[model samples]
Target chain A: MTDRWDLSTRLIEPAPDLLVAQPGRIVELAGMAGMGLTRIGYRMLSEASRRSPMAVVDVRGWASPAAAWEAGIDRDNLVIVRCAESSTWGQLVAALCEGVPTVYAEVPSAVRDRDLRRLAALIRARQVRVVLRPLRGELPGGIAHLRIRAVGVVWEGAEVGHGRLTHRRLVLEASGKGAAGMVRQIEVEDAGEDAVHVVSGVVSRASGRAG
Target chain B: MWFPAWSLGRPDAPAEGAVLVVDTKAGVVACSGVDSDVGPGMPRRQAEALCPDATVLIRDIGEEARRFEPVVCQVEELIPRVEVIEPGKLLIPVTGAVKYYGGEPEVVELLQGKMTAAGHDVRLGLADGPFAAEWAARIAEPGTPLVIEDTRRFLSTLDVGTLSGHDDIVSVFRWLGVTTLGSLADLPREAIASRFGAEGLDVHRLAHGQDRVVGPRPIPPELAVEATYEDPLESLDQLAFAAKATAARLMVGLHREGMSPFRVTTELEAADGTVRSRVWRSMSPFSESALADRVWWQARAWVDTGVIPGGVVRIRLDPSDLSGAGRQLGMFEDVMSQVEAERAFARAQAIVGPEAVLQAQPQGGRLPTEQVDWRQWGEPESKPERSTDDPWPGATPSPAPALIPPRPTRFEVEWEGGIPTRVRLGTRWEPVTTWAGPWRLTGRWWRDEESVDRYQIVTSAGAFLCTVGSDGTFLAGIYD
Candidate 1:
């Protein structure tokens, strides 16, 4: 069977633009700090909520509740676990291996490889899913069934007024077992408080590695 | 069901682009169009930061309700009895109507057809209870209805965070590691009751799908009560006493059917072959004593107005607009699964202290700290104080700082020739690779307070959204 699971297929009804995290697999969204990893995580949660109930584990306290609310994740459907330290990583991973469709977490760099493998193995055994978003470093090499990386960002700052950065072109690289290597650039424009307008594949490359 | 973007579709507003509805007082975007990721309860500044193309408008609660009136009226015609949950959401008990319409599918098709004919986009949800039905409708595709066959299994997989009733109970559930409705249902009932009280028990019942759902009360023809005086009553006292007994009998029967009417007609016949009748109405459902008092008043009015002459012989009480007096139950699953969690949570929050739980929303301010507002979760609605009409000059631009230290953490900026060349990040000093600003934001200059000069600096140690105040330099947030 293919490792990638299309989450929309399992929804009560089909919906578009939502990232699906299936049970019994680990998906890692790796990116540099400030590359909108948190924003992407929230977008996934928002879409997933429409399909099935889910929770978020903020191990590094990087997610802004205000931002999460704006991203369309219903506050009533979200359970935010504010991990005070890396010690609570085990507990969060355990929570993911339960019956939930998906669980989002910002995996701190300090987490041991043994712990991550154990978590991944448990998720596979229990038929649960995990979305690992690393805060500042490269995602741990092992345990990832899918890796989505933010390679570079091209930001457009407004020349007028206070010079706010209004638009961004984020180049992404996705690859993993059973997943074809592909490069897609997303147009990230401001829509509203919680909204990040994403038009996928402004630029694309077929089966390539990031330079 | 919930119309996620009902407020954004006014005739005057642009239909295609992103639209953001701001709650002025809190200064947050109350709602947004589906095309945009901006949801309700986001600050205007933050919303603008996320969606630059979005056209922002202040939310007009009156306009939303007024625009929705025609739709509600149209639905009431098809489904004899309909409950307005809110301006966009509605509930119609389909248990009896399902058989009439031939099945659940037909009922949905019938409603959808009528609503679509009326030039409105609508969806349908048919489940065992109102809670589940609303969710089924909300999550249903734009034109289809979601009919739930098994509510128990559907609710079991939902997050406990979706449980509505008491905010503290939900918060406690989160603290206790009860993440799903199934886990909550597995908890001992008495323990939940003793620890969280009636509100808690209600949530537990909802989780287990055991809520007491009192369906729509049908208007029975036998709701009226009558009385005949054995002898012709010559005085007003005799008529009053007779009316009192008849009203009591009517109330007992109405109560047995779990209904109370808002309006009742009282009829009286005089022994001399004269007749008098009048309709009595109350803002609330009529109680036994209140109904009797109204009946007595009708008799007195007839006698005073000379509408009736001689002795009174017969009296009757006819009730109309019979409404149910018990709670409705169905989906106790989380909001994503039920769609009624907000309303349920609002009610539960009222019983518990508001401050005990909170929901983050956007409010007006130039700085990150001033922009996002947090309110007590599920508090009574309040009119917004701030309007989006005013142009806020000197506010920092988009890509809001992800982390704003509860208190500013002092940071050193090695300044050379009035330009920041190097910045400090917790012991290690790194050269500024790329940077923007020295955005001079001068406000409230008349008052002697700490003013700010902000800058966005990118260093090797993650980009920093920092501010320089009169007191010292502070880290506003990290882009990460």
Candidate 2:
């Protein structure tokens, strides 16, 4: 005595988990410079590279490969491209989506709405995940599936002319189709010998998880 | 053949008597009319000190290739197939050309005469393989050809440093007392392979005068892809767009057969019934976008230089020297996905120039910017200038800045009681909430560069990495 609709629902694929980035979606990491946004993007790339190949389209030449290596990214699986011209950004990102499973790109200031739509369609068709970092400006509404903004950052283990910057605590607020109005706080620590990690206990508004 | 002083020998290079040095980001790449003390691979500052009167010029690779095109075209007239190793160096299989021209001497004489008449200094080398021939050309006097009857014997007399491009392996060989090519060749091939892996084996083979030879495979007729235009398009953009699709089709056909081409011949038909064909080569297999890029470069070079009049009718890509598809793929790597990614990267390179598409490799340096070496997408990785294993004192602490500005931007800083209290960003003044360092970094003191004090300052707005120097306080990077 099962419902016919329930039986048919089993045929369709379930929605992807919200904790991690979903395939075929544009995840936007929006924040000003020095607000821990880029570090978060690198962490995502490191995680993505563990499963599949990843790339970074560094539009402003802002990406620090040393920092990315410290963030635990697999260098062999990562490709970093530095692009400056805004005119070619759309075409380049679209081409990247064709091959790479995950792409973290710095968004240029003036991207046409048509290009975003075209990119969104391609993303869905190819099942590629794109993480967009718009430091200069914001993307148009309805383009991004998830948006994570760095609200605050606190540095520890450094004082006037004394200890070096050893650790940071970052608070992020994520809101989108997946986790609407969810806030999370995470701690990033610099372990000695070229290792940086997000140390445990990611306290989410809805549920606490290990990061 | 090798063009002596290739960079300085460019037609647009400075007049003959002037000492010239051509440098790139990696420092001095080529020089001419300078003493041996100021040779290639030396730091520019060091080179400049050695030759005080030398005129330094930045390397313009595109210009070098453009200027070398005529020479390649000239060579093609005498030999149907010629392989260009770089702008200043090329290789030709002399077997067919030598027989047709009666002998190796006749072939060399004809080529030298052709180049000399065209106002170019030329040197030729004849041997069994490219490796021996290149060395022969290097030692050959201008306007003369050097022929080696026994390539192995000739190679045996050379120094171990002749194994260029394998600096790390060569250094190891030098350390092991293998100072000559003869000593390296004497080592068992399997032993070299086991120690240094595939690249070491390659060097050993070269030392033995055995070049890695891949015979050109016969291409299936249906594998060749072509695009025909009804209305004769003349614009470069139109031709490039057409070429992209045609190149993709050729790649698909090759992929279906589990093969990829290391060389391709791009044929273009002009509206005036002129057909131009050029062979483009790559060290690695040509991806779809790479083949397309070569086609674009060829078409643009022809059209802009007026070599091909009224280019419009047809475009064709015929691939050769096909190798197994997964020959370059690493273990556990998904071949299809990796190939697709490379194709996309090459396409991106086409949109932006090749230099813009980069891959980063960690290297030794104190600063974040200097610690990573950025190489072009497909080129073999070069040895790091410095060794990371060496302890770098005064190096920036890790968790390096995420956003490093291409150039540090000047900022206004107000000091209070010998401490930076506030910094002006744009029109707003943000008070420093916390701060660290005045880590004094004196870089390359030998060059008389000023010392700079770097600080990590946190304000209510954000955190910044800034440097205080004689010039001014500048924002160097962001900790984002």
Best by DockQ: 2
Model 2's alpha-carbon lDDT is 0.75
Question: Which window of 10 residues has the lowest lDDT sum in candidate 2 chain B?
Answer: B323-332
Candidate 2 fnat reads 0.70
Q: Which CAPRI tier for candidate 1?
A: incorrect
Alpha carbon lDDT of residue A67, candidate 2?
A: 70
> Taking chain A of candidate 2, what TM-score results?
0.78
Residue A139 lDDT (model 2): 75
Candidate 2 clash figure, as a count: 0
B141-195 in candidate 2: lDDT tens per residue?
9888898989989999999998876788999999999999999999998899899
